[model samples]
Target: MAEQGSGGNVIAALCCVFFPGLGQLVQGRILAALVFAIVAFGGYALWFFIVPAIIGFIAHVWSILDAAKFRRLS
Candidate 1:
């Protein structure tokens, strides 16, 4: 994943995939931005299948969070 200033947002991205809100919550996005994850998943859940939406969220959250944690060390 791409690293950010430090720790990146890897955790957030990971959480997004499985629990979208988790990563944003971790990044301290004021709970509002996370709403997008829900709306996004909810909106397209039917088209992509609820489970996949969850997976997608997880991937995004993970990538972000991972990048964060990894960047710090880098």
Candidate 2:
């Protein structure tokens, strides 16, 4: 796995705070990035209904943490 606590990881985490999947993209996790973007945005689009909106919030936070913790395989 890639070494942890790099400056890039911090930047990626920050990116995720603004957009869920952006951090994953920064970390080279293309597939995960696409999935996170779709799910997070999709959930937000449904936010008008209220219930499922919570999923969006959850996904947002999850993405941030996931990006911060992600490690690339060597």
Candidate 3:
């Protein structure tokens, strides 16, 4: 992937807007993608409760930020 704030990062972040961890998957981070998907979707599954919903929201936002800020080690 490109550096932070690059076009690729921008696209990745945008992808996250639709689904948490989708950006990570685009960025080639399989583990992170799975983890984010599980956490965010899992929390969302329990939306009946307020706390889980909030946690899901936070995870969704965090995934977007993480994708946007990701920098490959050189």
Instruction: Give each model's whole-structure lDDT.
Output: 0.54, 0.86, 0.93
Question: Model 2: which ten-residue window has the lowest total lDDT?
Answer: 1-10
lDDT (tens digit, per residue) of candidate 2 on 1-74: 26566788889989999999999998888998998888889889998988668888888889988888877776
Question: Please, what are the lDDT tens digits per residue for candidate 1 over residues 6-73?
Answer: 33365556565665456656665655446656555664565556676666565455545443464323
RMSD of 3: 0.7
Candidate 3 local accuracy as lDDT? Answer: 0.93
Model 3 lDDT per residue over 2-52, tens place: 698998999999999899999999999999999999989988999999799
Worst 10 residues of 3 by lDDT: 1-10
Question: Which ranges of candidate 1 are over 4 A from the true structure?
Answer: 1-5, 44-74
Provide the TM-score for each candidate, comma-separated. Answer: 0.43, 0.89, 0.96
